[model samples]
Target: MSRIEPPSTDPVNSKPARAATGDGLDPGGRRRARRYDPDRKTRILDAALDVLAEHGAAGTTHRRIAASAGVPLGSITYHFATLIDLRAQAFARYVEQQSAVFEELLEVVRTREEFVEILVDLVHGGPARYRSAVLGFELHLAALRSPDLRVLTQAWTRDSRAALARFTGPDVAARLDALLKGMIMNVLLATDPEPREATRAAIVQTLGPADGSRP
Candidate 1:
C-alpha cells in the first residue's frame, strides 16, 4: 500500500514516467505480504499432538502435520528440524498440559472417596482424557527408540509421581504410577471397560492401609 509519487504528472521532459515503486511491492497489488502469525508455532505443536495421538510417531510427517495445521510443508521444516524432534516436543507439551489437568483434578480431593473417584475418572475420563492417554502411550513407545524422548518420559514420570504422592505416600505413588499406566493401556484396548467399582477397588488397594504405607 505504500505508493510512490510520479514525476510531476509526466510532462514533455519526463515523457510519461512510470511511478517509482521501490518498496518491494507492485503498484498493481498482485502479491501479498508475508503473514504475521505469532501463534504459528503453537498451532503446529497442537497439530503435532493431534497427529501423534491419532497416527503414532510412525505416521507423523511434515506433510501430514502441515495439512493438519493449515501451514505450508516448509513451515514445518522451518520450525522443526525433523519429525522426531516435533514428536518429542509435542509429547513434552502434552505432558505439561496433562500435568496441569492432573493437578486440577486432584485439587478438589477432600477425602479418600474423592481421591479414589478422581483416579477412576482419570482411567476412564471419556473424551477429555482419551487424547491425552493416547499421546502418553505414543510417547512411551517413541521413547524406546529415541533417548531424547526417553528423557522426557522419565521426567514426566517423576513429576506425575510427585503429584500423586500428595495423596498417596511416595512409595504408593511410585507403585500407583505403574498401575495407572498398565490399567490405562488395558482400558484403551478393552472393548468394554471395567466398571467404576472395580477401578475404585484397585485404587484403594493401591492406597494400602489408611496409614499411607505401601500395600
Candidate 2:
C-alpha cells in the first residue's frame, strides 16, 4: 500500500480550509459576517402588519413574523420581548402612519364641502384602504383585551380628534370621530358602500356646518 501522504503543504492547496464563522454565507461560497440593517426593525414591524392582516392577532407569532420578515428568529425577541410588546409597537406604527395620512387630508381642507368630499373619498378609497381599515379594527378588538394596546388606541383617538378639531370644533370633532368609525365599518361590511352623497349628508348632519370653526 502506498504510504499515507502527510497533509499537503503546497502553498495553494495545503492550507487547511478556514472554518465558517457561523455568521452567514455569501453566494460565492465564502463566509460572510452577518450584515447589520439599519432598517431591519422597520422591516420587521411592517412584516408584522402584513402578518396581522393575513393572520389575526391570535395567529400571529414570533416565528411566523420572523419568517415573513426574512429575519432571523432572534431578531424579533431582540426588538420586542413579548407578543404584546410586538403588537403594541406594530399598532403604534400603524397608527402613526395612518395619522400622517389623516393629517395630510386635513391639510387640504379649505371648506366644509371639501372636508365632506375628503371624508367620502376616504370611505371609498378602495380595497387597499379597506385592508388597512380591517387591520385597524383588528387592533381595536385586541385593545379591548389588552390594556397596553388600549393605551395605543387611546393615543390614536386623541390624535385623530385633535386633527379633526383643526377644522371642526372639539364637539363636532368628537362626533365626527364616532361618525367616521361607524361609517368606516359600514363601508367595509356593506356589499356596496354607501354613496358619497349619503356619506356627505351624514357629515352635514353631524357637523351642522364645516365652516372651518374650531370650538
- Give the range of the ten consecutive residues with the poorest summed lDDT in model 2: 1-10
Model 1: how far residue 83 lies from native, Å: 1.6
Clashes of 1: 0
Q: lDDT of candidate 1 vs native?
A: 0.75
TM-score computed on alpha carbons, candidate 2: 0.80
**TM values, all candidates:** 0.81, 0.80
Please provide, for model 1 over 1-215, each residue's C-alpha lDDT reduced to its tens digit, 9 standing for 90 to 100.
11111112112322322222443245886644757999999899999988888888889877778789998666677676556556666777777777777878788878777888888888877886888888898888877866556666776787889888888878989999998898898899999988878888998898877864321
Tens digits of per-residue lDDT for model 2, 8-125: 1234422332322432556787856657799999999899999999898999988889899998776777676566667667888888888788888788777777878888887777
Q: Which residue pairs in model 1 clash with each other?
A: none
Question: In candidate 1, what residue range of length 10 has the lowest lDDT sum?
Answer: 1-10
**Compared to the true structure, candidate 1 yields what TM-score?**
0.81
